[model samples]
Target: MCRTTVANPMMNEPWQRLPALSLKQLQYFVTLAQLRHFTDTASRLAISQPALSSALRQIETVLGVSWSTVPLRRSL
Candidate 1:
């Protein structure tokens, strides 16, 4: 029996060995992106404002990218 393995650069990377990100972090990131307001997103998510900010910062640090510089969609 032969098992052909697919290669994923992200999966092979050293950083990829790290644990998965929390669902809460992803939720905060998405909410912040859609609302563009920390306070509003925090309230909507029922999490504290500082917690929302920390979640975003932690993700950005782990991913080595800034969400502020990333444009997900065109705004009016």
Candidate 2:
């Protein structure tokens, strides 16, 4: 006999409250947030550094806050 366990839908509910982030923006933010280096973040995002910068700028404009002002904890 085989058994399967499904994650409780409620356990994943927190994700529902998050604003939708485009794949490009999400990748860019994740890279930038992890590295805190624009150049590196751009490289990791597979876009021109300028493009990456512009994307982040657009995100800031849309969200009305600079990413620098946001709190992010470093992963140990």
Number of the top lDDT candidate: 1
lDDT of 1: 0.80
Expressed as tens digits, the lDDT of each residue in 4-45 for candidate 2 is: 999778867877766667987877887788887888777776
Q: lDDT scores for all predictions?
A: 0.80, 0.78
**Superposed Cα deviation of residue 61, candidate 2 (Å):** 1.9
For all predictions, the C-alpha RMSD in Å is 6.7, 9.4
Candidate 2 lDDT score relative to the true structure: 0.78
Stretches of model 2 off by over 4 angstroms after superposition: 1-18, 68-76
